[model samples]
Target: MFILKRQDVEISSIQHPKRKQNIPILTYQGQSFRLISVFSDHQQEEAKAFWRELTDHRGKACVLLEETDRFSIWGKVSLEQLRAEESSNSAVSTYTKACILVLQAVYIDVEDLLGGRQAGLFQKDITNLFEKLKFPQADSPKAVKHWLNVDPLSNSSVPAWEEHHLITLLQELYRLGKEYFGNTNFAQGVRDILQDMPANDQNQFIDWLNQSALGQLWQ
Candidate 1:
């Protein structure tokens, strides 16, 4: 039996035409895995909580999306989402992208520190350690879900050196702010950019920053 932990699973509803209401089901590659009850009044809140739990056990947990057959690492998903959202021109979106890049750099650095990659395998044992901080917009949850279901091990090459590059980019952003807006504190500049973000996004960004290398420097 393929037992899945409740903490590792997220329940999404699908239409049940005959029943005239939505039914909560867990499916993987068109196979019915489990049926779970819908108890939470707010579906988005429940999903966010589930994601946080998954993030806490990222390396140990295997994320299996109902729409995909393969399990994926948390880091791959975070990277995919970061790439997807990086094009947005909004202030919050830009700041969030930078933060994700920083986290990814740290992740890669840690992987390098543990052991140089062995030939024929791409850090298979390294956990992708990051959270899906933003809630998916209602218009494209399925697409977002699919994008995050990436198999990190499928890649043949290690990520290019990024820690110093990303740090330089962050410093450049801070410099631009100081030159153009007279904001001396980089953290304050980040706060200003995030001013218009929704409360949930702001809170998630704060949490992510607190765990980042930049956050350590700021402190």
Candidate 2:
């Protein structure tokens, strides 16, 4: 089982001063994670160095992102590099991107529930990243509805905006698992994380997974 433990560390205690923002010190099982984010070359270099430090222990590493930070040039360049590295047999990079997508989805859902300002920005960044990853396009209202498992005739009966965002999140999960982890282990990894989530989130994600095209994989 995968376990996530989040710890609060002082700024003065941060080993890398230059890459300080949004840095969450998360641990899976007993392995410490090196969470990195990039908004420029300097941050990108820091991320690369962090990756190197993992060496044979890279499986414990992942990415940390904020909704506002994902749209920057630094974010784009950093993700592009990570995606490229994924294709080159870097398991750590692949898992980092996958984990980021899941976290981004959860962030969007929380923001929408609370009527937060950054929901739109999160949605846009999620869409852009999915496109860059070559996942199926949820470009049209109809496409979004399909992915969300909403009945076409009930479109007017549902909250379209929330449904659309949920679909985007589900599709990212499905595609990431399918494209990178052969649609099996990654689904299990997601299930492991879901088990640790709040009851509300667990129910929501479980419902979506059961309704999605990738439902059988999860089963």
Candidate 3:
């Protein structure tokens, strides 16, 4: 089960009294979504209230929650439900670029092996990994899994992006959050902190452990 409040970005998993962490919630930008593991069903009152809140905002906003699992992402619900109004050349170009950039990010991680002795051995895997997707050329699942194994900072395969282009894309994402949910800012501070990260030394590991938000995401 899940609930969404567009006014904020939030996502949460529902909890039972017996659960270790009793907070039955995942909230993203003040919007809350929940996954119910113990309760096999929704209470009538809870359902009614949730339905009412959503219906009241009908055309104004949207939310999506899987009935079996509590998972949610803002604006995705409405966007998926509603067909895009019009198709434009610029929109097509934007989609293609996003697809290409994401794929490039994946490819850079392995491109170093392209001319090496390992190339023949991994060729099939690489081909399959880059196979086309509904979202055009997206990173293959295999590549993404490999990305998960990599330490973002340690990996020497970071993708190249024009400084202006990278900043523009990031800024666009930031503005989307601000315009819709009023987050105002996202990732900027994190990026700044990352830029200031000290070189690996005796204290590097501990300092990184303390400063990193990526590590906290799993928890």
Candidate 4:
């Protein structure tokens, strides 16, 4: 939760470690592994330099993962041996992040996309999606509405949704287009949407799309 500790430094944030250290903790899965999050308030170029240097890593516990706006976020892991292999958690989460990015890019005004009648159905679909998934916030009406409340011109924070949650949403969005609007050109529509996105986001979304089930339509 605490992404940053102090100026360019981050503290560990996992449950109990074999050896007790001076930091807070939370249980992950059934196994508790200590983790840290490093943050940098640097521009893209400087952040890249910092990332290159930090990744030399050695015994350090932070790896650069993003370069956005005026900050870069790094996942700081407390590992005795810095492994070269990527974590599955990070890889899976990237899909959710990219999907969130696409949603943010489109920033739909439900009224514009679905109109009054179909908009209600779209809302019902979202409610049902969360309820069926049994997400912690499934019962929260605001949580269901959160997905629809996007700002077209703003870069919003992404919800901490898992891969399944995002994939299902993408499927639902596709379904809504097909069923309600008769917009069968799903992949081309995505391509057109990306034409307006930032270069980095477009590339990231493309990578996710290429691997996603929905992207198969046009590819």
Tens-digit lDDT string for candidate 2 (23-83): 2233333434333222222344433443333332333234332222221111112333433
- CA lDDT for candidate 4: 0.46
Minimal lDDT window, size 10, model 4: 29-38
TM-score of 1: 0.23
Give candidate 2 misplaced runs (Cα > 4 Å): 1-42, 53-105, 112-117, 136-193, 196-219
lDDT per prediction?
0.35, 0.37, 0.33, 0.46
The Cα error of candidate 2 at residue 183, in Å, is 31
Cα error of candidate 4 at position 20, Å: 20
| Model 1 per-residue lDDT tens digits across residues 37-123 | 111222334333333443453332323232232222122222233344334324344343444433333333334543444310212
Task: Identify the runs in model 3 with alpha carbons over 4 angstroms from their true place.
Answer: 1-60, 67-84, 87-89, 113-219
On lDDT, the candidate that comes out on top is 4
Q: How big is the positional error of residue 190 in model 2, measured in Å on the Cα after superposition?
A: 8.5
RMSD of each: 16.8, 16.8, 17.9, 15.4
TM-score of each: 0.23, 0.27, 0.25, 0.48
Error of 1 at 178 (Å): 5.4
Model 2 quality (TM-score): 0.27
Q: Model 4: per-residue lDDT, tens digit, 1-219?
A: 222323434334532233232333323323222322222344445444434543553333333434333333343433432232224445544455555535433335445665777676667775765675454334456766765565323544545454435555665455555666565554355656556556766666567656534465432
